[model samples]
Target: MLSHIDPNNQPTMVDISEKSDSQRQAVAQTLIQLPLALKPYLQGEELILKKGPVIQTAIIAGTMAVKKTSDLIPFCHQIPIESCKFVIEIDSTLKVMITCEVKTSYKTGVEMEALCGASVAALTIYDMCKAVSPQITISQTKLLTKTGGKTNFKRVPQPLYGLVLTGGKSKRMQQDKALLKYYDQPHAKHIFDLLSNYCEYVYLSARREQWCNTELASLPTLVDHDDDLGPLGGILTALETHPEACWLIMACDLAYVNAGTIEKLLENYHDEVVATCYQNPEHGFPEPLCALYTPQALKQFQRAKTAKIYCPVKVLQMSNCYFITPGLAQEIANINTPDEYHQVRHEHH
Candidate 1:
């Protein structure tokens, strides 16, 4: 795709004079699967290295790569990067995945910048550890996602309250459960703040038209259903916005919520895609709207949304949902009508 621009032929940077000045961001990731023997080197606790610390060198090298992107890629336009942040996360199998997110306020996007940064960073890892083991394999070198470059794009969809649908919203709950309040903040805002504890960038998923950002009118508010179909609709939106990350879908009406509860959910979260389990006297295994979801449930939710079975419990019961049963039921109390809202509000919200 980048083979078009000829900087030498033009002798000057091509003018994106007609392009819109929308904010642009790019996310690139590279997976480095290393042997368990080398995992200790990356633990960062006591990086006692005769050569030097491993991660510190990688960060410095990655930053340099960001500046040299245009020179490395001939057709790529040189962008003055405003900010670049790199994160390294390790999977249970000792595989280190590095993500580079670059942001810029300019005429063009910084995808090349982010890609170069991540690639160089991964290569640095290989260069540092090749003497110990030659079995390092780097794969999945594609953009995790990018938005705002002449067009809006997302690798996945998202939800409104914490970007995942944990359950269905009954009409009796005049207020969209997500709108309920706790800690002097709305329910959705509470969860939004909590998820920020784990994720680098947490976004609220809702129809762009339904909500307004008083602070930043231009901040992207994701739209679902192209219309509103309730909680499942928001869930689909979240899946659209961030398809790769694990989403915690806590019902807003859940009164006894806290960040600690979210940490417990994340602590018990299995890679097999999981949700919280609540045993109801009436409904067996009442799949609580308080669950964590992954892209594994996207297609099922899409099909259900089409068939009017937008309830998340049904999806959990019928599909392969890893249930997190910590016997934490009190935190799952859902608020329905005004009376219930007040009742829960007064009793320790």
Candidate 2:
């Protein structure tokens, strides 16, 4: 599983040619326990030793180390560091805390650079204060945070869940749309099974009448609220049910949606935006039925509900959203009428 090793078990540099350039950043921390003999050098927040200002010297050394990290580590890419910063402070427990932050816009991340910078800065501090006592100990060095790679490291992580919206009244179809079998099972079950492959959990949002009256009865279901907000009501119910997890909402009537479409949506997800959706080819607006909604997106929908705006697309337009082009013209198509449903069923088969 290691990227640095090749098939032949020889050490190799990871190929970054296929990776896209992004704004990557990493922060690393190093702790140094100062001996009691060096207490007199601490003048206010500044630590000035006989060799010069200790903090300033360590910062300079760390900056150099950040730029020269490729030389120190064999596998590290020579990243063009855009920014290198340091924060040095002494706590009440006489421990000198050194933190190094590195930023770069490149195909590879700068975590190693940040870690190297903090480590060298700790070493420089030890060298400067060694004249006072050889007991200066470099205690810990670790990466605090990193972003803009394949995955982001954070203190708290959110679980991703799937919500199949099956509560809509199919007035045009004149039948329960969720119960129609498109792929050897109910369409609602098809989408639920699709989502189960990628999400932590998958639930069906259905009306009270459909809860146990159809093929989807055996599945996990969330009864829609009686307020009659349609799909928006089901979305709000799921969000409120599990506020800690992000929801990927899929309409049961989407006949053309496949696993690839869902993968593309999740690949483009960004936490800063309220939602990530596809641009509706027909309307030039966000396709809310097949989109990923974050916890913050729930607030937007709640505000819209209070203002009597029940349209999920309108709510998404009023707030910030990231949109990607649908892979195919039918990727966002949902069958509302019996004619369209029959045509799609024939075409899909």
Candidate 3:
């Protein structure tokens, strides 16, 4: 089932007439191995040759190739390229690494353009250095990443950590809300297990005192460092502890947030924005709990916290957040008070 093949097995271009235009980007890399004879020409980081700046010439050729990618590739669409950038470096091992990044705003992706750009840049490098040695070889031309297609893909994804916020004071519930058992286990453990299914690591974001119990002490915990900030404090603690990690933050009292709801949230996630969350169907606000937060979002939260903005919902509202409506609005509801807890507990379980 080739996308560029017709029913009769004839080659054809994909019909993107009905597709909506979006910002698309792709990155590709190519490796070129040079001979030891070229080492004398490699001064510092630049390769100086009578061919007039080998790297610069290759960059120009790569940029041109990126623009004319459609002319070379049979099925590629003629996309108006927004930008093409190249980074070429030569190592002590006489190996040159060329990276090509291509950007466009079009219906189809620019993966082919990026691949062409890198391949052509490697070829140009080989052409310039072949006079020095016939042993120059090009290898490993591949796409590294792509965005704005049906799905975004990355060769090396950032570490995704999960946090179950259980640091709430729970005054309204007349009990520790996280300790309430909606399922067979405690609420916090249920959410922790659910998040564990998807994330690389899962932790219970709890207050230090909450860990006094043997049961709570046994679970992996990230104790709240900031005091009296509710769920915001737990989130900040998790982010501060692992600055490089992206988070899937969930509250303990979100009784209806099952595995399926988390899957939907993850399916809509993209790292370009600060966060990805659900649009609260009742109030038209972004649901901060049960959301995915990246490092970019964490930095903004830190700035907002310094400015005395503690509401997670408000921070999400002001930031660049991708919001999607849940299949069922009730799946995003959290039990904040005794009445709410009792009602949901009786109705659901």
Candidate 4:
């Protein structure tokens, strides 16, 4: 049946009053081909022009478009959007991909809202960058995925990897804690196993000298590219190696961490945040070692590195990070000293 056509052959809005309210979501994407000359101006995640920051302005414009979708599109029902998220990425080819995801609990789907948001965002990018080069082009705009209603659908999940941080000096532990046996296997291996259950690829973050472990030799490893920076260097190395995939980072000393905690982290994951981390019960700050870092977080870390700031926790604290308290406080317990390690080992055994 035609949704916008009445018996009189006039465009009409479909009556959705009889339809039951259900949670609905839609994701739409658009690509903007940026000029090569303008690529260098994109410092970190956004470019600043006379109007303002390019990506940030586009995000605000997209959100406004999502809310005004019905007003712009004839016969489209106005939806009270529960949430709107935008992910903007610029690739090596100077192509910008803008994705807008909209969610609502309404009778009709939000495909129009998502599409409108993406289209407006692309246009805003073009307007902001046009002074630099008019060669910019809005290549494509289409709905990537949607959910709810009778026909629920989804695209494949984004490529997400895992990084197990084992690059620390272990000075407090008085030994290489990563090689310490926790469950008849190396501590690094145990954490690797936990991350492997959720990620398609899992890598051990280690120093060059620590690569001698026979068990870790067979698995993928991201050796630290820089020295003296500790876990911050390892995280930057992982981000440099895999710039596209989000990294789920876990420290080797987290002896009490289990698959449940990892699952909860994934379930509550927020893509828009720089990083999603568990709040340290003792410190009341984000636990950086066991967290999800998106590309934005990586960019922020790189900026911090250039400024001689080497603390990952400080970076998360300063950026747009999401922190949640774990269901079990012990899930974030890190076994730093030999006594603590021994106690945790004995308790588990």
Candidate 5:
């Protein structure tokens, strides 16, 4: 229904030139809690499913939808996405989660892209599983969270650090964030150094690609690789790779993370604490960029990284983790494009 944005009066993309310049991104996912009858048909032997590989095809379709979200929705702005990634995962009981992340350098937000990716993936599941049973339920198609651009918005994700994913085609960046250097230091190195003091033996997880070389070469680094789940793949691999250790995770894109902020979290950490971040007054939730995780807290989330329930926070919410209180907000600001880098540099200096 026409709830947030007006429809009949006519839909038009809003101009956001007056909008403040800040890192903006959007995350959305759909939950397809399929019935038990459709379980066997959802997953078949081999990466290839009975009709089609559900995760792979859904990802491809989701990415394509992300690129054309403006065309699909009249009010959606046609912004050039810096990166787009989709992940599909299923739990032990066969509940699926599909999550999509859309990043860009633009005047407006990318909620449309995230929603489009989730919606298209859900539709793809419908197309793939119709043969087995028409009983699939594709509800919860909405923007889970969004930040950057005019409004640095967010929704409260769960406190558990079920996954810390870092995957993108990087065709545009011409380099992966993991290997990219800032101040003669690797990007992941920046976060690693920032988080290491907070979490013991912070795991360095990544796909074993040529670009992932430098990041992986470090000794004692945990390898988290699952190509099918995209970025979520990295998170699953992290949990699986270091099943025994407590994990505090962050993305490589965020270059200005403050160690003191994270250290404060470590100072106040409790056994029940799951995630920690500098809370946003506008968003009202712990930011995902800087989060802590425990093993027993979310083992099922790692197992279900390749099905419909692909969002880590969804599993984290269900699993339950405590958020570190007031003092630790604004610690994470992701640097996506040239403009953003310059902006952050200006802000810091």
Candidate 6:
């Protein structure tokens, strides 16, 4: 029976008063194709057109559409939206994908809200980019997934990998931090072994000069594709190499990170957020080096790269990231210099 049609064949709204209230969520996605000629103008975070910053404007438009979904769609129930999030990405093929996730605590689903949000976001991109090139085409508007209410569902979790960053310049340390022995083994080898416990596959992120170490020759290594960008380049290389996998990244300089610290991070993982990071107790910011980054976060990193913002910490600061402080604050410490290394070594021993 059609809920929108009555026995008298008249259009009517479904009565949801009897339905029990429960948390509900939905996700929708759409893509916009830009002509190859216009791709050059689409810079990092903002494409400053005559209208405004393209990506930022699309985000606002998408959020507004989520709130006004009921007004636009006649049959959709007005939902009290608890939250709405957007993830936008521009791939190598010049296809821009916009995903909208909507959440509510109500009797009905928020699928329409998600769809509306994604549609509006795509339209906003088209509007902003039209001045640059009229060849922009929006397509693939559809619901990606939904949850809560009577039925609950989700897409498969992306594959996950462990990435040990071993490319730091180590100017202050005056030696390769990764090669320094902490537990009678090279720091890089120690971290790799730790990550192996939780991750299905592990790889080392290194620079050209660091890749030829005879001790590290047997292990899988990813040379930084953009060598000048430091840790940011390592992360980008990992994401670019395996776009479908979530990366659990650990820096070589983190001498105190152990199994318990990794366990705590994994236990407190937040899938909805782009990344789950440790909050630096000293600096009061998310520690970028030790974190679990989902595929959504990788896309944001791509956007940051386009905008010439090479700092991963800055990207995490701006995006929706879940941060937690370690029980032992010292566990997250980075041994950047010989003094710091000696101090940590003494403490551990």
The lDDT leader among the candidates is 2
Write the number of the candidate with greater lDDT, choosing between 1 and 3: 3
Q: Between candidates 1 and 2, name the one with more favorable TM-score.
A: 2
What is candidate 2's lDDT per residue for 1-349, written digit by digit as tens?
6999999999999999998999999988888898888888898877889899988999999999999999999999999999999999785446787889999999999999999999999999999999889898896687778999889874222599999999988999999899888779889999998999888999999888676766788899888775499999999999889987888899999988899999888866656568889998888989999999888887898899899999998999897777899989698888999989888779768
Candidate 2: clashing residue pairs, number: 0
Q: Where is the poorest 10-residue window by lDDT in model 6?
A: 151-160
Report the CA-based lDDT of candidate 6 relative to the real structure: 0.85
Position 74, candidate 1: lDDT: 75
The alpha-carbon lDDT assigned to residue 307 of candidate 3 equals: 87
lDDT of 4 by residue, 230-305 (tens): 8899999999998888889999988888988887777556565688899988879888999988888778989999
Q: State the RMSD for candidate 3.
A: 13.5
Go through the candidates in order and give each one's C-alpha lDDT. 0.65, 0.87, 0.86, 0.87, 0.63, 0.85
Error of 6 at 264 (Å): 1.8
109-198 per-residue lDDT for model 5 (tens digits) = 788888998899889877877777778888767676788754565443223232233565555555666666665677767766666554
lDDT of 3 by residue, 1-349 (tens): 7998989999899999999999999998888889999999998888999987899999999999999999998888999999899999776777788889999898999999999999999999989999999898898787788999799876532698999988888888888888888877888888998988888999998878686754567789998888777778888888899988889999888999998898777766655568889999999999988898988887878887898999999888788777899989989998988888888879866
Q: List candidate 6 stretches off by more than 4 Å.
A: 1-158
Cα lDDT for residue 203, candidate 4: 96
Candidate 2 lDDT for residue 280 = 88
Model 6, span 166-269: residue lDDT tens: 98889999988898887888889999999998888999999885757467777899999998998999999998999888888999888888998887767555
Give me the overall lDDT of model 3: 0.86
TM-score of 2: 0.61
Cα RMSDs, all models: 12.5, 13.3, 13.5, 8.6, 17.6, 9.4
lDDT for each residue of candidate 1 in 32-54, tens digit (9 for 90 to 100): 78776676666543222455765
Candidate 5 ranges with C-alpha deviation above 4 Å: 1-166, 170-174, 212-216, 273-280, 303-307, 325-329
